[model samples]
Target: MSRTAHVNRTTGETSVDVHLDLDPDTVTVDVSTGVGFYDHMLHQLGKHGGFGLSVRTEGDLHIDAHHTLEDTAIALGSAFAEALGDKRGVVRFADATVPLDEALSRAVVDLSGRPYCVHDEPLEMADTIGGDYPTSMTRHVLESFAHHARICLHVSVLRASNPGQKPDAHHIVESQFKALARALRAATRREGDEIPSTKGVI
Candidate 1:
């Protein structure tokens, strides 16, 4: 069976459409979000997650990436949750750790039927992330993604004390994406080539 999902979301302020494909050996992505930063992040997510993804977002960046970012995350999460359908043949758990210079982060995910987030990063850059979008905004975007994905997500920054480590925002975010992607990749892998549930139905 083909494993893929397509999602579309629109509001008065923005519109988003996304596609996802789960496969161990292939990854394809076509991301076009009005928010350049967001587009880059999604691209990294697809590359790191070991999946094929295509996404497009048209949001009121003229105001801010708030709605656009949150909505995009929600749509992508919804697509991920839907694509896993029944969670059959799914490993259902993933984890990864990555670093960019002095900045290191780790992320864990459980494609469980639950939505939870554990974010423990500082607020030093709450207003500016790599001089792009606000770190707080990224945090909220992550929350929105987790809320819609229906998965347990935990992110921890191991080195948040280096005052001078304003690490490349794009690189920092991409590293996080890579870690999340690896974890998701592992969790979604089929073990023993069998469905990972005892219910024999997912």
Candidate 2:
């Protein structure tokens, strides 16, 4: 079966489109959301997760990036869930830890057909990155993605502080995204022709 899906979502605040291919012949990532940092993050996610992802979003950015990022994440998650289908032969669960400079983060994922999220970030991290992307939106994006994807996701920033330097929000956030991508790459792998859950479904 071809594992691919496309989603289009439009609201008063934003219009978003996402395409996902889980078993793509070649990885391709294209994202344009008006939020530069977020675009880079999503690129990392698609590239590291071994998936083909394309996203285009337009939002009322004069107000803020909240709607754009949230809606894009929702669309991406929806497409992912659709592409995954019944979860047959899926690896279903995985975890990964990644580090960027002084920052270290970990992500755990379970494609359990249930939505839950636990995200922890460093308190000392900067308030913003790339001038416009609010650091607080990181958790919101993950939560929205997990809910729409019907998956359990846990992301934590294990270390982001240096002895003399303040925490870098960019590094912390990038590490988290990379870790999440690796975990998702593993969790979404096909192992055999059987459902991973004991109930014979996921």
Candidate 3:
């Protein structure tokens, strides 16, 4: 069966749409959130996770990127939850560590039908990446995604090669996203026809 979902969300601050497909063979990705760096990160989520995903958003950018970023994540997360359905046969738990140049990050995921997030990163950024995407919003994005997706997620930047120097914000965030993608990919994989939970539901 095809695990797919489409979601549309609109508020006074933003309007967002997301399409998600968990089947690896149907993988494709298209993302536009009016923030270049954010779009790149979303692309990494889909590509590295082996999910077919699409996202489009329109927001009051004249104010800030917060609404756009948060709403996009909310929509994407909802789409993922909807596609996952009862989460039957899924592996349900996974972890991954990814490295990018001087940055190393780890992500752990659980498809527990509960919303929670714990994100930790020590990198200090120059306020914004490319002048539009705020460096601080990275954590907010993950928190919002996890809340809406109803998944337990934990992300941590374990190490940076530049221990005494300013680490590259781009690499730090990118590695986390890559790690998150891999962990989610593994956690959502189909393992059998039975639900992976003691309660017989996920």
lDDT of 1 at 189: 80
Residue range 55-124, candidate 3, lDDT tens digits:
9999999999999999999998899899999998999999999999989999999999999999999756
Instruction: For candidate 1, write residues 65-172 as lDDT tens digits.
Output: 688888989999999888877777677877889887667789999887779988766555446543446556667777888888888898877764367565455455
What TM-score would each prediction reach against the true structure? 0.88, 0.98, 0.97
**Candidate with best TM-score:** 2
Write model 2 residue lDDT over 1-202, tens digit each, in one string.
8999999999999999899999989999999999999999999999999999999999999999999989999998899899999999999999999999999999999999999999999777678899889999999999999999999999999998788888988999999999999999999999998999899888
Error of 3 at 183 (Å): 0.5
Segments of candidate 1 deviating more than 4 angstroms: 129-132, 161-171, 192-202
Clashing pairs in 2: none
In terms of lDDT, the poorest run of 10 residues in model 3 is 159-168
Off by over 4 Å in 2: none
Backbone clashes in model 2? 0
State the RMSD for candidate 2. Answer: 0.7
RMSD of each: 2.4, 0.7, 1.0
Tell me how far the alpha carbon of residue 126 in candidate 2 is from the true structure, in angstroms, after superposition.
Answer: 1.7
lDDT of 1: 0.77
